[model samples]
Target chain A: MLPIATIVFREFLEIALIISLVMAATQGLQGRIKIIMLGLGIGFLGAAIIAFFTDTLAASVEGTGQDIFNAGVLFVAVGFLSWTVIWMKHHAKHLSQRIHKVGSEIVAGETSIWVLVTIVALASLREGAEIVLFTYGMMASGQVTWSDVFTGASLGAVGGTVVGVLLYLGLLRAARRHLFAVTSWLLVLLTAGMAAHGASYLIAAGVLPDLVPQMWNTSHLISGESLMGEILGVLIGYTPHPSGMEVLFYVTVVVLIALLMYRPWHSKAVVAQK
Target chain B: MRFSFPMLSLSLLLGMMTLAPMAGAEEPTYTLEIKDHTFSPETLTVPADTPWTLIIKNHDKTPEEFESTELSREKIIPGGGQVRIKMGALKTGTYPFMGEFNPDKAKGQVIVK
Candidate 1:
């Protein structure tokens, strides 16, 4: 049950991002739909391949080994994705203008529309790939139902599409400015939590000894595997009591990355105006 | 502090190989006796990368399941019978085997030297 909830939450976030991007390309950019769909199909294929491999590899390494690998992957991915999100928010206006200029310049060249189509398609595909990896990570943890993940993903995509369409139609203009900001911060939190989760798994595998055994006892309330913890676990990488290094990994990574992003584009109006 | 990369790997590899008694290329045959629901000589030493057969003679009255998640293999043997587990030149590590029915009493460790 807890696993189901976890799947739903992760899928919701992933689908929301995908829908937002698709809508942004179609309505916002006044781009061709056929090209975008083509890109999505390609992305789906790539995602399927990645999902298959990640599943097989994860199965080969369970308990301790599985946990360490998951944590490492999550750390790197979160770092990369967070960086990309921050970059996009800071430069979206400039990027859009640049893309429009490039599009117009190459409009006279051989199939400029195809280039734009390819660009949007590739971006969407990248997002799809991330979704596959993230979903696999959640499943490998043995905490969620496949049904919950699919259902959540469907709902999230639908909701995102609606919001994206609204944004494209100029119905939800104000929301766009802060959307990336909110998502970026949430990602920071999630990644930090993942670090701790990874540490715990390593401890379980005996790869790393419990330097500080029982960071804090939560058996009285909700054990680590409880439904509540599972939900929190997926949402923010929650741990009942974390070790010193685990806490350090969580706090330092999230806070440091957030700090790096906050300084340059902290002002909503400034970024939105650009 | 200034150890060359290849040299470092060689040293570690050599150390591990020496530490693991069953890690030798030469295959060795041994008998594991299970009497009174306990594995005799709980620790079996063998060289790594050496193919070996684990002959389990269960002289107990009940059944026992020899399970190893790491090895991805499990075999069940009934009372008054013997079973064979083929360790095909196993990797250099301790492969833990347990009896599903009597886990506490039916515990044993396979050490790859």
Candidate 2:
């Protein structure tokens, strides 16, 4: 078996390299020192907080506590995801507009390098934190090994780096611009699944007792402990036998997000300024 | 100026009167003990509607930290020493806790039974 420590180190190195590439692409060589430092600082801080919390939670809920923790985490994850989707729906367009505006300024100014650096730093920090948190959750779930996580993370970094480079070269600028939407939707899908899984955990704990708890049992199709199951679990929070709460959580999250998307409340502060 | 001075004095008096009850308020106490990598007496049964002062004693030689997810509370207790926890009325159910710094030999439970 591979050492978990080695795998984590490799993952960190991969992320660092990806950030470096993004820096090279967006900021060039003129003036990116401060922005680069800020990005690194944010990324590391986010990772450390996530790691510490995950470890603490894992240790606390070792035995039967595990089930409780899983359910609790699942519920909270669902709530958080619902909030995120609604928030994004309302603000993402505005955010992109602001970025384009800022991009124009950077392109026009002599201190353009500094602007580019800050943009790159902010973007990387946001995405980096998400990647790290999601990876940690995957690791804690026992659906995959440290090696699997490292592998996924490394691949993601490679993919993200290539996109960053192409973006800088102007070969795939449109695709880069499309990233925010794509990643946001991806996160929504991922969170919905996590919420369902969490409800399943709670169901097992009797906290959420349900009639006809087995919503079309799929263990015969894909056991929860199998590799395919793990993949499904990570991507869409798939469970073999979901209880009523699981279904309820998943459907609720979807509905709430859909509503928010229909009539989002854009920040009044921004609109008021306009 | 004279009117303003009297108003300020009256307000100060009212503020002191309001804080008198708070000044005499007591901190909640909780009792937690660690043994065998598990928190002995895992269910820390406390009053459902009242604040608690947790006094945790780590009898084991391993360093341990007591953490609860539902409560979102954590306090590190040095081996052979003790730590204190203060909590308000928490929702009914089992709140899980564990030794974070060392998970091996210092394990136990805290049941709010």
- Candidate 1: tens digits of C-alpha lDDT, residues A56-125: 3333322122334433444434444344444544555654666666763322222434443443444344
For residue A217, give model 2's deviation from the true position in Å: 3.1
B38-104 in candidate 1: lDDT tens per residue? 8887888887765665666667654454655443234444455554444454557776777654556
Which 10 consecutive residues of model 1 chain B have the lowest summed lDDT? B1-10
Cα distance off (Å), candidate 2, residue A134: 19
Candidate 2 residue-wise lDDT, B1-113, digit = tens: 01132244235434433332221136455566776446766666776655555666667554454644344344444446554343544445565555543434344444444
**lDDT of each residue in A1-274, candidate 2, tens digit only:** 1222332333343344334433423331333555566655664675456434543433342212333543443444344444444554555565446666565343323333333333334334333433454444345435468777767656655554554345334523544656545444544565677667555543333334344434566766887545466445544567665656667777776665565655446556546776
lDDT of 1 at A201: 42
